[model samples]
Target chain A: MSEVDVVRSSSMADEHVIEQAPQSGTGELDALAAALRDGQPSAVEGIYDEYGGLVYTIALRFLDSPERAEELVQEVFLAMWERRASFDPMRGTLKSWLCTMVRSRALDMLRADRRRPRPAYSLDSADGDRPAMEIPDPSRASDPAAVVETRAVLSALDILPDDQRETIELMYLAGLSHSELSGVLGIPLGTVKGRVRLAFAKLRQHLGIHLEVES
Target chain B: MTTCAEWEEEYLESLAAGSGPSLEVLAHMESCPQCHLLLQKDRQIHDALKEGVRVVPPPAALKSRVLSSIQTSPSAPQLHVMTEGSSPARSSRQLHRGSILIARLAAAAVILLASGISAVNLARSSSVTNAAVALQLPGEPVTYGIVQVHPASGIAYLANASLPAPTPIEGHASEYELWYIPSGGVPIPKGALVEGPDGQWHGAVRYPVQGSGLIAITVEPAPGTMKPTSLPIAAARV
Candidate 1:
C-alpha cells in the first residue's frame, strides 16, 4: 500500500488534533532573548530557570552521565548567550530552538565518544553501578501541562511493541543517526528505517488527539 | 513531482529525528499552506516525543557558574557599551587605558609560557614522553586510578587505580587486554596486560595508531583475539 494509503487505512487521523505552530513570544521570552543578546547575566538565569531541566534531561538520557549532562546544560546556555542574535522569533518558539541546540551538542558528544562495539551483557561483567533513569515529578515540573504531557508521552511509549519502542528511543533520545541505528541494532538500513516509520505510526495512533494538544 | 503527502511524511520524519528539512522541502512549505500546516503538526509530534524523555534538574550551582563565566568572558557581547555611546574625550581616555592593558597581557603571557616549559620538563623525567590525555569514564567519576595514553612511547599507563580484576568465565581464563583502535578501522590488540607494581597497568604494543585513534582497555576471554569480548573499562584518544 502507498504510505498515505496506509496512514488513512489506520483511521487514526480522523480524530487527529491539528496543533498550531507555537507562536513567537511577545512577552517574557522575548525580553529574555533580547537581554541575552546584550550579554545580560540576569537573562542567563531566566532562560535557565525556564528550560534548564529539559536541556539537562536530554543530555542525561543520551550520555547517561549526570556530570556530563550538567556540563552540557551550561555549554548550551553559554552558546545561546553568545549567538543570541541568530535567534529569529518569527521562525519558531524559543523552546523549540533550544531543544535543537541541546540535541546537536548531545549528538556531537556521543560521536566524540566513538562508535561503541556492543557491550557483552554477561551476568558477571555487567556494570552494577549504573544509575537508574530519572523520572520527573509532575509536581516539580515547570507547569501543570508539562506534567500531563509527560505522563501522556510515557503512556504512549509503554503501549508500543518492544522492538519498535527500542528502535525509536535509540534513534530519537540517544541521538543515533539512521546509519548508527542500523549498526547498533544489527539490522539492515532499510529495516531500521522501516522500524522507525512503524514506531512513529503507532505513536501517532496512540497520541492522536493528545499529540495535537499544545502543552 | 512528488505528492504533498510524501513530502509531509519526509518532513515529519526528519524533524522527529532531530534534523531540519531539506531545501526542497522548505521551498515546498513556503509556497504551500497545507505543507506548512503539516510542518506544524510535525512540530507537535517532535515536542510530544521530547517529553517522553525524563527530566533531571541540573545541579543548583550550574546557573551561577554559567552566569559568572559569561560575565567575565572577554568576548561576551559588549552590546550595551556599543549601544550607549560615550563622548569622544572619554573614548580617547578609554583608548589610552586599552594600550596599557595590552602591554600587561603580553607580560602575563611570557610568564605563563615559562611555567608550561617547566611542567613539560618535569613530565619528561618519567617515561611519559608526551602530554597526558585523561580518559573519560561514563557514569561515576574514576575513583581509583587514572588512565593516560602516551603516543610517543606507544604505551598506556594506568596509575594506582581501582579497576576490578576480571573474573574468569566457566572453562576459560579471562584477562584485561589493551587495544589500539584507529579511526574507521578494526581494533588491533596491542598486548596482554599484567598488573604492575603498586597495582598499575602498562604495556608497549606494536600497532601503528593514527593521530586520531583511541587506546582502550577491554576484558577478553583470552589474549591475542582479534576482537574484544567485553566493553572497555576505560578509553582515551591518542
Candidate 2:
C-alpha cells in the first residue's frame, strides 16, 4: 500500500495535542522520504495532515502572529520537501529536526523583520508577545488519568517562581540557546543555567518524578 | 570537562537551554550509566514540554497552497544525487556565456559539494546583449543548463533540457516562478514562467536585481502565489 494509504488506515488519533508517540515514527518518515524522492504528490498532504498543527504551534510560539506562523508552516514543510535528500533519520527523529528547523527559520524571520525590542516586563508582556504559556486542554489526553496528569504538569509549570518560569519559557518555548538567553536577559550565563536547573527540579517534583536535581 | 557532580549540573543546564550536550559531557555520559539515565530523563521532560503546548491549526488556505506548490515542483528523482561535492558556486565567479571557463573549472576538480547551485559574476560580454548562467540540479554528473538574465531589463529566461513540465495546482494550472534571493533578505518573486513545448520559461521582473544576487526557481500553483510554497529546485548566486 502507498504511504498515504497506510497512514489513512492506521489507528493514529488526530485530535490529541500531546502525541503519545514521538512525532513521526521512523517507519512513517522513511516512507515519506521515499515517496518524496519518487516525486509522489501525496507525501506533502500526508505530512501536513500528520504534523501541521505541531509545526503551527511552534511557529506561533516564536513569531506571535497567526499569519506569520502560518507562513512559516508553509515555508518549513516546503523546505522539508525540497531538502528531503538532506534528512538523516539516524541523527534524530523527524519531529525534533522539524522543530529545530522551524525555530531557526522563525528566528531568522524575526531577525529580518527587526522590530523594536520591547522593554522587558516582570510579568508576561501586556503586548501579547510572550512565548507560549497556554496549556492544551487536558481532556485531550488519551485517558482520564493522562488528562489529570497533564493538568498537574501544566499547573506545576504555571506556579513556578516567575524567574524560573521565565527562564524555562525563554529557553524552551522561545528556542533560545544558553548564550542567547544570557545576552537577552542581561544575566550571567551561570545565573541563567542556575535558574533552569531550579525550574526543572521544581517541575520534576511537581510531576512526581524522582529524578535527582544536582546542586 | 569537570567532575561528575559538576558535569551533572552542567548537563541539565545545557539541556534546559535547548542545546543538548557538549562533546565532553557526551563522552562522560557514554561511560557513566547514571549520567546516561539522567540524560534520558532530561530528554523526556524536554519532549513533554514540547508536545504539551496548545495546538493551533493552520489557516484553511495553507494546506491547499502547500499541496499545490509541491505538486508542481521539480521531480524528486533528481535529488537522489549525493550531497557531497565541491560547490560549483565557488567557481561561479567566472560564469560567462561561451566562456570555455566552465570546462576548465570542471576539470580542476578537487571535490563536489551537495545540492543548491551558487551563481557568481554572471554577465554578458561588452555587447550587454544576453547575460546568462547555468542552473545545476542535483545529480552525479550534475545536471545543468543556461539561465539568461537582463539586469537592466529586469527579465530572465530559463532554458534547461532537464526542466520538467510544470505540475498543475488543484483547480488551477501551474507555472514556474523565478525568485531573486538577496543576501540577508527574504526571497522576492520576480515573475512566473509559462513553459512552451520546448521546455523554456521566461518572465519580466518588477525591479532590477543587482550584481552577485542569488536566483532560484520553484514550480508553484497557479494564479501564481505571492510567496513560494516549495523549496527552489535550483539556487544560484549571480
| Consecutive 10-residue window with the lowest summed lDDT within model 2 chain A | A1-10
> lDDT of each prediction vs. the true structure?
0.52, 0.52
Q: Residues A1-215, candidate 2: write the lDDT tens digits.
A: 10101011011112223332235666887787677656576777777876777677667656665545655776687688878778776655455557767767877877877842221221253355543344445566565444444445555666677667656755654455666666555689778777876776677767654333321
How does residue B47 of candidate 2 score in lDDT? 57
lDDT of 1: 0.52
Cα TM-score per model: 0.37, 0.40
- Clashing pairs in model 1, backbone N/Cα/C closer than 3 A: B145-B161
The stretch of ten residues in a row with the least summed lDDT in candidate 1 chain A is: A1-10
lDDT (Cα, tens digit) per residue for candidate 2, span B146-165 = 44334433333344324555
DockQ of candidate 1 is 0.13
Q: Which regions of candidate 1 fall more than 4 Å away from where they truly are?
A: A1-26, A115-132, A135-197, A200-215, B1-53, B77-238
